[model samples]
Target: MLIKRVPSAEAPLDLLLEADPSIDTIKRYLESSICHVATIEGETVGAHVIQPIGDGVYELMNIAVAPAYQGKGIGTKLLEHAVNMSRKLGAQRLELGTGTFGYQLAFYQRAGFRVISVERDHFLTHYDEPIYENGIQHKDRLLLALEF
Candidate 1:
């Protein structure tokens, strides 16, 4: 597998939608962000996008691994790459928002993210439709950050 930086605006829509259902939301930050992709034999499998939100701080707005390759550590690799890349770019902190409960939340935690706060009813108010994983509905956005 190989990891490389790419133009965030042109990131594959299907893959982006896999992690974030709303095109509008994706468009909100992607156009101006930095994107990294994970590939195997030249086939794209996962992607992550980050954009600066403040001085020395960046927000990981999107990250996903295709269903066919979800559990193979590609997502974690991409994350590790992001962390290193962020440091190179002089970032002091990295942040992201995910559902309060889910593998995604746990994934970030395992990567050294700590809960900062919760945006109550974020999904109910922002998403056009409800998001469910493991039969559980997503209601709030769990704000997490990794401070280096």
Candidate 2:
């Protein structure tokens, strides 16, 4: 597998949408964010977006792996690449938002990110459609950060 930066225009939107449901939100961020892709044999299998949010902080706006490639450590590789890229770009911290509960939250925690705060009703207010996992609705957003 190869992980490399690519223009936002070249990002695999379908794969990104697997992680972030809102197309409008993704497009808005993609305008200024740096996109990276993990490919194997010239096929994109995973992707992540990182945006510098000033003050030496960067936000991991999105990350996703193709369903067929899920559970093969592709997401972890993409995340590690994002962190390294952020460090190289002088980021003092890396942050991201995810559902308050889910495999995603645990994934970040395992990667050394700690929950900084919670945005209550974030999904309820932001998403046009409700997001549910394991039969429970996601109503809050957990803001997590990894300090370098």
Give the best candidate by lDDT: 2
Per-model CA lDDT versus the true structure: 0.90, 0.96
Tens-digit per-residue lDDT, 66-139, candidate 2? 99999999999999999999999999999999998999999999999999999999999999999889999999
Candidate 1 ranges beyond 4 A from true positions:
none
Q: What number of backbone clashes does candidate 2 have, counting pairs of residues 3 or more apart or in separate chains? A: 0
Model 2: lDDT of residue 78: 91
Candidate 2 residue pairs in backbone clash: none
Give the lowest summed-lDDT range of ten residues in model 1. 4-13
TM-score of each: 0.96, 0.98
